[model samples]
Target chain A: MSEHDKNTRHLARMQRKKAVVDTKIESAKISKGLLLIHTGIGKGKSTAAFGLLARALGHGMQAVVVQFIKGRSDTGEEAFFKNAANLQWHVMGDGFTWETQNAENDLASARKAWDLVQACLQDETVNLLILDEFTYALKYGWLSIDEVVAALKNRPPMQHVVITGRAAPQALIDVADTVSEVNLLKHAFQAGVQAMPGVEW
Target chain B: MSEHDKNTRHLARMQRKKAVVDTKIESAKISKGLLLIHTGIGKGKSTAAFGLLARALGHGMQAVVVQFIKGRSDTGEEAFFKNAANLQWHVMGDGFTWETQNAENDLASARKAWDLVQACLQDETVNLLILDEFTYALKYGWLSIDEVVAALKNRPPMQHVVITGRAAPQALIDVADTVSEVNLLKHAFQAGVQAMPGVEW
Candidate 1:
C-alpha cells in the first residue's frame, strides 16, 4: 500500500480501537479496593507485588508486606524498603517448605503471619498489603482457605491486597477482583545461568 | 493419619524435594547478564519492569528506562524515581497507538526511542535498562527486529535488559534468557471497577 493510504487505514483502525477503549473506560465508574492474585509457575509474581508496593509507597500510601514462604530477610527489596516510614515488612517463614521440613512448624508460622494480616485488614491506614508466596500456604493446607477468604472479603473498604505465588487456590481466585497467571515459557536457570542479586533475589 | 505419622511423612517428602532443588541450584554456576521478556495480555507487565527497576536502584546500580508506547510523564513511577541519582527515564511515544492515530508519527517516535536504547546498550555503566511497552514497536514493524536483536546481543556483558508488552515477537523471545507470559484470567475493570492511583498506574 502507498504511504498515504497506509496512514489513512491506520488512522481508521485506531479510531475504532479508541472508541471501544473509551467505552470500556467510561463504563468502569465504581472505585474500590481490589484483591489481586498473581499465580502460576513463573517468575515475577512477587516481583510484581514488590512493584505495586513501590507504586503505593511512591504515592505516599501506607503499605505492609508479609512474606509467607520466603524466610530470607536479606533480599534486595527488604534492604531497600526497610527504612521507609510508610512501609512495614515482616518475613515470617523459617525457610522454604523443603528447608523447614516440619508441617507443624510451617503451620505455626503461617498462623503467625495470618494474625498480622488480620490486623492489617482492620487497619484502614494500611493502603496496600502484599502476601508474598501466600498461595503455597493455602495449597499446602497450612492455612484455612475459608477463613482467609472471609478476611479478604471483609478487609477495609479502601485497602488493597495482593497475593502472589504459584498454584493459587480456586477459592482465593473466586474472591479476587484481579488475577494474572505468570506462565514461564523459558528460564535462564534452565540454561545454567545463576540467579543474580537484585534482579533475582 | 496420626499427627506423628503426618510429620514424618512431610519430613520425608521435604528431604526428597530438597535433594532435587539442591541439584538444580548447584548446576547453575554461570553468572551473566540476562535478557528477560514479559509478554501476554495481562496486568503488571510494565509494573513488574518497574519492580525490577526498584530492585536495581535499591542495590545502587545505574538504571535507565525507555518507555516506547507510554507518552505520559506523570506516572507514579516517574514521579517517584525522577530524582533518583542513578537513574535516567525517557518517555518517547506521543501516546498509545489509538490515541496518536498516526503511523508516521508513531514510527518516528519508535525510531527516536530506539536511538536512546542503542546508546544505553553500549554503555557498560548502565546496569539495567527497562524498555516498557517495547513489544508493540516490534509487533507493529515500526523498528527492525534484526537490528534490535543484534543490539541486545551485543549489549554490555553485565547489563540486564527487560522488555515488557503483549505478544512479544518470536525473534525477541528467542534471544531472551527468561520469558514470562502474564495471562489475564480476571480483571477488576471487567467487573466495572475503576482503575485507581498507585495500584493501577
Candidate 2:
C-alpha cells in the first residue's frame, strides 16, 4: 500500500477508537468515592498506592496513610511525606506477622489500625485513605473481614480508599470499583539483591 | 499442638526466614544506579514509575520526567508536579501515534523527545530519570533501540532510570535490574467507567 493509503487507514482506525472511548467515557457519568484494590504477588502495590497519594496531594486533596504492617521502619515515603502539607501520617504496625510471632499482640495492633481506618472512612475532609498491607490483617484474621468490608462499603461518598497487599479477600474485591494485580515477572530480591534505601524502602 | 507450641514453631520459621533474607541482603552489597523497567499490560507501569520518582525525590534527589506520548492532555500528575522543586518535567509528544496519523511527524516528535532524553541521560545532576511511555517510540520505529540502550548503559553510577511502557525491548529488559509486568485482570474503563481527574490522568 502507498503511504497515503496507510495514513488514511490509520486515521480511520483512530476515529473508530476515539468513538468507542468517547462512548465509554460518556457512559461513566456518575463520580463518587472509589474503593481501589492493588494486589497480587508482584511488586509496586504499595508503591503504586503512594503514587496515588502523591497525585492526590497534587490536587490539594487531604490524605492519610494507615500502615498496618510496615510502620516499624522509616521508609523513604515516610521521610518524603513527613511534613507535606494537607497530609496526615499514622503508623500502627508492630512488625511483619512472622517476625512478631504473637497473635494476640498482632491482633491488638491490627485493631488499633482498624480504628484509625474507621475514623478515616468517616471523615469527609480526608479525600484519600491508604490502607497499606491491610490484606495481611485480613488474611491473618487479625481483623474481621465482614466488619472491615462493612465500614469500607459505608465510607463517605467522595472519599477514595486504596488497599494494598497480597491475597486480598474476595469480599473486598467484589466491592472495589477498580482492581489491579501487579504480577511479578522478575525482581532483584529474588535474584539475591537486597532492597535498597529508595528503591525498596 | 498447643498455641504455645504453634507460636514457638512460627518463631523458628521466622528465624529461618530472617536468616535467608539477611543473607540475600548481605550478598547485595553494591550500591549504584539502576535501570528499572515497568512493562506489560498492567495498570501501574507509569504509576509505579511515578512512585519511584516520589521515593527518589523523598531522598532529596533531583529528578526529571521526559513524557514521550502523554503530552497531549494536561494530566493530574503534570499539574501536581509542575512546580515541584528539584524536579523537571517535559512533555514531548504531539499526541498518540494513531491520532497524529503521519509517520514523519511522529518520527520527528519522537526524535526531538530523544534529544531531551539524551540530555537527561548524560546529566549527572539528574538522580532519577523517567522515560514515560517510551516503548511506543521504539515500537513505532521513531527511535533506534541500539542507541537508546547504549545511552542507558553509560548513565552515571548513581542515577536511577525508570522506563515505563508496554512490550519493553529484550535488550532493555536484559540491562534492567528490576522488571515488573502489570497484568490487567480488570480495568474500570473496560467496565464503562471514565478516567477521573486525579485517578486516571
Candidate 3:
C-alpha cells in the first residue's frame, strides 16, 4: 500500500477503537469499593498485591496487609513498608503448609487472620487491605467461604481489597470485581536459577 | 478420620513435600541476571512490574523504567517513584498506538525508547530495569525482534530486566528466564465501574 493510503487506514482503525473505548469509559460512571482476586500457579499474585499496596501508600491512603501463608518477615516488601505510618502489615503464617504440617494449627492461624480481616472490613478508614495467600485458607476448608464472601461484600464503601493466592474459590471469584490468573509459562527456578532476594520474594 | 490419624497423615505428606522442595532449592544455585516477561490480557502486568520496581528500590539498588506505550507522566507509579534518587523513569511513548495513529511517529518514538534500553543494558550499576508495555512495539513490528533479543541477551550480568505487555512474541519468550501470563477473567470496568485513581492507574 502507498504511504498515504496506509496512514489513512491506520487513522480509520484508531478512530474506530478510540470511539469504542471512549464509549466504554463514558458509560463506566459508578465508583465504589472493589474486590480484586489474583490466582493461579504463576508468580506475582502477591507481588502485584504489594504493588497495589505501594500505590495506595503513594497516595497516602490507609492500607493494611494480612499475609496468610508467608511466614517470613524478612522479605524485601516487608522491610520497605513496615515503617510507613499509614501502613499496618501483619505476617500471620507459621510457614508454608508443608512446613507447618499441622491442620489444627493452620486452622487456628486462619481464624486469627480472619478476625483481623473482619475488623479491617468494618473500619471505614482503611482504604486498601491485602489478604496475601488467602486462597489456601479457603481452599483447605479452614475458612468458611460464605462467611468470607459475606464479610467482603459488606466492606466499607471505598475500601479496596486484594486477595492473592492459587485456586481461589468460585464464590470468591463470582463476587470479585476484578480477577486475574497468573499462568506460568516458564520459570527460572525450573531452569536451575535460584529465587533471589528482592526479585522473587 | 480420627484427629490422631489425620495429624500423622499430614506429617507424612509434609515430610515428603519438604524433601522435594529442599532438593529443588538446593539444585538452583546459579546466580545471574534474569529476563522476566509479564504478558496476557490482565490488569496487573505493569502493576506487578511496578511492584518489582518497588522491591528493587527497597533494596537500595539503582533502577530504571522505560515505559513504552504509556504517555502520561501523572500516573500513580510515576508520582510515587519519579523523585526517588535510585530511579530513572522515562515515559517514552506518545500514547497508546490507537491514540497516536501515526505509524512513522510511533516508530521514531519506539526507536528512541530502544536507544535508551540499549544504553541501560550496558550500565552495570543499574540493578533493575522495567520495560513497561514493551511487547506492543515488537507486536506491531516497530522494533526488530532479533536486535531486541540480542540486546537483552547481552545485558549486564546482574541487571534484572522486566518486560510487560500483551501478546508477547515467541522469540521474546524463548529468551526470558521467567514468564508469567496474567489472564483476565473479569474486570470492574466491564461491570460499568469507573477506573479510579490510586487503584486502577
Candidate 4:
C-alpha cells in the first residue's frame, strides 16, 4: 500500500477509537448531582442502590437510606454501613409488603417512611437519599405517583435520591435524570433455590 | 376484636414468622475477605471498589491492588490505600490501550498485571486482592477466561473477590456465588454536564 493509504488507515483507526472514547466522555458527565431511580423485577435493586451509597460515603457525602420492604430483616449491609459517621441509615419499613395488606396501614407506614425520606431530602447535610423499595408503594397503589414526584421535584437542590424496586412508573422515569433497568435473565429462585446471604441479601 | 382473638392472632403471626425464618437460616459461615475489580464506563467503580478495600483494611485484612488501564491516573484512591501498612497498590498499563496498541506491549503489561493478581491470589498472607480493570484482559482476549477462572476458584478458598464492570462474561457469572450488576438509566450527559470531585471519578 502507498504511504498515503497507510496514513488513511491510521486515521480511520483513530476515528474508531475516538468513538468509544467519546461515549465514555459523554457518560462521565451524566450524573452530576443526579436523581436516579432503579426499578425492575431482577434482584439486587437494593444491593446496587446501597453500592452507590457506599461510593457517596467514601467521598464524604452524607447518605440516608430508607428501607421500605426490608424493615424487619437484619441486613448485612446495614450492619456494615449504618454506623459510618456520614451515613444515616434507617430500617423504617414493616418488613416485606406482602405481609402488609390494609391500604390504611400501608399508607400510614409509608407516611412514616416518607417522613424519614423527607428529612433526608430536605437536609443540606445529606447528599444522597436511598429510598429502598419505594417503587412498590406505587406499584401497589398505596401511594400516589404524582404526590411522590412532586415531593421529589421540590426536594432540596443538590440532593440525589435513589429509588429501588420493580415497575417504575413512566412519570418516575420521565423525571429521573438516570434510570437503570436491571433485567432478570437468570436467578437462583427460578431453579427452586433461595436467597443466599452475603451473596443474595 | 375480642382480647382472646387478638392474642391468638399475635401468637399465630409469631409462629408463622419463625417457621419461615427457620427454613431460611444461613448455615454457611460468613467469612470476611476481600477481592475487588473496578471497570466500566461508570464513574466510581474504582473508588467504590477501594472503599471496600479500606473497610477490609479496617478489619486488618491483607490487601494488594493492581491498577490496570488507569495506571497513570494517580487517583486519590491509590494514594490513600497505598499509605496503609496493610495495603499494597501497583499502577501499570502506563496510559491506555490506544496509546500503546502493540499486542506484545499489551501482553507484557498484562503479564506484569497478572503477576500481582497471581501473587495476591496465591500468597496465603494477602486476604484481599483488588484488580482494577482486570476484566479488560478477558474482554480483549488478552487473557484466557479459563485461566482466570482457575486462578480465582483456587484463590485462598476463603478470600472474597469483587468484580465490578460492564459486560462481565458468562463463565465469571457462573462461578460468582454472588453477582451484582449495576445498571445506568438517566445520566447527566443528556443535560450537558461534567463530574465533580468526590462525586465522580
Top DockQ model = 1
**Model 1 error, position B175 (Å):** 0.6
Model 3 chain A: lowest-lDDT 10 consecutive positions = A76-85
TM-score of 1: 0.97
lDDT of 4 by residue, B6-112 (tens): 55665577567766755554433444333333333443345446545554555566777787766555443443334567777788675566655454567678888
Give the TM-scores of the predictions, in the order they appear: 0.97, 0.93, 0.97, 0.72
Worst 10 residues of 4 chain A by lDDT: A190-199
Better candidate number, 1 or 4, judged by DockQ: 1
Which 10-residue window of candidate 4 chain B scores lowest in summed lDDT?
B32-41
What does the lDDT read for residue B73 in candidate 3?
Answer: 77
How do the residues B1-201 of candidate 1 rate in per-residue lDDT, one tens digit apiece? 999998999999999999999999999998998999999998888888888887878788899999998887767778777877799989998999999999999999999999999999999999999999999999999999999999999999989999999999999999999999999999999999998887887
Q: What tens-digit string does per-residue lDDT give for candidate 3 at B119-196?
A: 999999989999999999998999999999999999999889999999999999999999999999999999999997
What's the TM for chain B in candidate 3? Answer: 0.96
What TM-scores does chain A show, candidate by candidate in order? 0.96, 0.96, 0.95, 0.85
Per model, the share of native interface contacts recovered reads 0.71, 0.49, 0.67, 0.17
Local distance difference test scores for all models? 0.91, 0.83, 0.90, 0.65
The DockQ value obtained for model 2 is 0.56
Candidate 1, residue B26: how far the Cα is off, in Å: 0.6
List runs of model 2 lying over 4 Å from the truth: B1-3
For candidate 2, the docking band is medium
Relative to the true structure, candidate 3 reaches a TM of 0.97
Q: Write the per-residue lDDT of candidate 3 for residues A36-63, one digit (tens) a residue.
A: 9999999788889988877777777899
A26 Cα displacement, candidate 3 (Å): 1.1
**DockQ values per model:** 0.76, 0.56, 0.73, 0.21
Clashes of each: 0, 1, 0, 9
Off by over 4 Å in 1: none
